[model samples]
Target: MIDKFVPSVATALAGVKDGATILVGGFGAVGQPDLLIEGLIEQGAGDLTVVANNAGYGRVGLARLLAAGRVRRLVCSYPRIPGSVIFEDLYRAGRLELELVPQGTLAERLRAAGAGIPAFFTPTGAGTRLVDGKETRRIGTRDYVLEHALHGDVALIEAWQADRWGNLTYRGSSRNFNPVMATAAELTIAQVYHAAPLGALDPEAIVTPGIYVDRIVHHPAGALHA
Candidate 1:
């Protein structure tokens, strides 16, 4: 029954409920899954807590969600530029809830979760604001801060190519977060421009195996950048 690949982002996210935590795989503009984001907006799934590297730029990426007011909180590692639509509005109204993580630690936390580790220690922000109120321990006179794993109900990712069975290959920086997020989410939805049959993609090229992906959404054509 799961043999055929889904064709739309909305269909892929049909099972996601409101208020779900989501790990969105993207580092800035490159790795984002646009179709799924658009579909989530259209579906009006609200009160979401989203985890991503950036909130997207302009109207082309995660900014769309901010514009739609669908997401309630964002956990990311970057600062938004002043006067940007979403950033400015959120700042002026104090409506946005943000949790800033150290860039490397954020990625590692997600990776650790996917690998089944509950937590890990990092020295990335030992005495900085990023470690405020966080637990710390000293190992051999050096303080290491604790960072917990991050998992989600669903993860939205974009890949360059995928198979009917969900094997995925990402292009460029899209490779960064998609693979890790795929494993950390209970359900992972991928939007790929091409969908090959299962086993068609060489084993070596399968960055994310089919087992991690719950649904494959095929979007053969669209303006990915605008």
Candidate 2:
């Protein structure tokens, strides 16, 4: 088996390039990969497009990347949070581009990309501004909007535990987006609290199969800033 572990966060994210599209796994910092984001900040690769559930809040995690002005565009369900002033400021100034999708729609798009589906139609945003300029069709009696699949150059995810082969197990609500995002990217990196032996983790308990994960970094205790 190929060893997927990397010595440090920087090395795990070493291949990320400028102008790359990144799928970030998180829901309000719960599942955010803080160390990976930190490495990205230090890497200083600019003009990135980030896809997540929300813009980073406070001064940590994704917020640090946004504050550094590294992200050129943001695709997410919620861009504004109580303390996301950096994102708001940049967006209002037109320095950052924003694509706001409905929460369910966003999840489906990512899932579709991983499933090899190029696009899918849904009634979620049929009559709203979300469908503006997009193709629309009637199915049965309801109108549905066509949303294209979303894929990324890299995926950053956080998990509670991982085996040597990269099989991942998430803790509680922190599992949000991580599993799906793992399959939607060309390269998938995971930050885990613990690293187990090849067969230590129960096969039935693994949330994300190792085949979808490319790299794993063990996160330091209390590493999360928010």
Candidate 3:
């Protein structure tokens, strides 16, 4: 049998090690997997590198994880949005390391990783400080920089629905970074609002197929407001 359901968030995150790279899915808090993050905090694997769209909001989700001192580095596009106090304090005090990537570039990098492409060129940060120490090439008067694919040891996802086979679906913008992060990680753990019967979901509505997801934890309140 190929059942991927896990009983709890802690079980979903089992085997994650210290010094692991975790891909955190969210566009601000929309698709952020807060319950799994809380479980990760309780699981206590430190010295992590977290990749996300932004630092975090208020003192919840990713922000709380950083404050817990589990994260050694953060790779994000927006390190400073409103209520990202925890990341700011840790960064300013040199307790945290940061790698700022352009939002579009970050998404592409993860996509490329999942697609099995080692590297790609894009014009997003071609002539800026973001491209420093990187290779640049000009094609038809437009300059592009080479970006390496980003792979994760684990990806924490938030889904609207999932099946025992691990197929997943998301609602609205909550789908934002979840799919790409799912495909790019070695072990993908999803916190879903519902665990539907194997054939309950419409085929066309399935946004993330079962092959990319490894574990699913049915959390009824996971995305109530997202």
TM-score of each: 0.93, 0.97, 0.97
Quote the positional error of residue 196 for candidate 1 in Å.
Answer: 1.2
From the highest lDDT down, the ranking of the candidates is 3, 2, 1
Report the C-alpha lDDT of model 2 over 123-172, residue by residue, as the tens digit. Answer: 99888887899999999999989899999999999999998789999899
Q: What lDDT does the true structure give each of the candidates?
A: 0.83, 0.91, 0.93
lDDT of 2 at 176: 93
What clash count does candidate 3 reach?
0
Ranking by TM-score: 3, 2, 1
The residue pairs found clashing in candidate 3 are none
Off by over 4 Å in 3: 222-226
Write down the TM-score for model 2.
Answer: 0.97
lDDT (tens digit, per residue) of candidate 1 on 78-193: 74743246755774697778889988998999999899999998888999987999999998879999899999999999899988778899887779888989999999988888
By TM-score, how accurate is candidate 1? 0.93
Top lDDT hit? 3
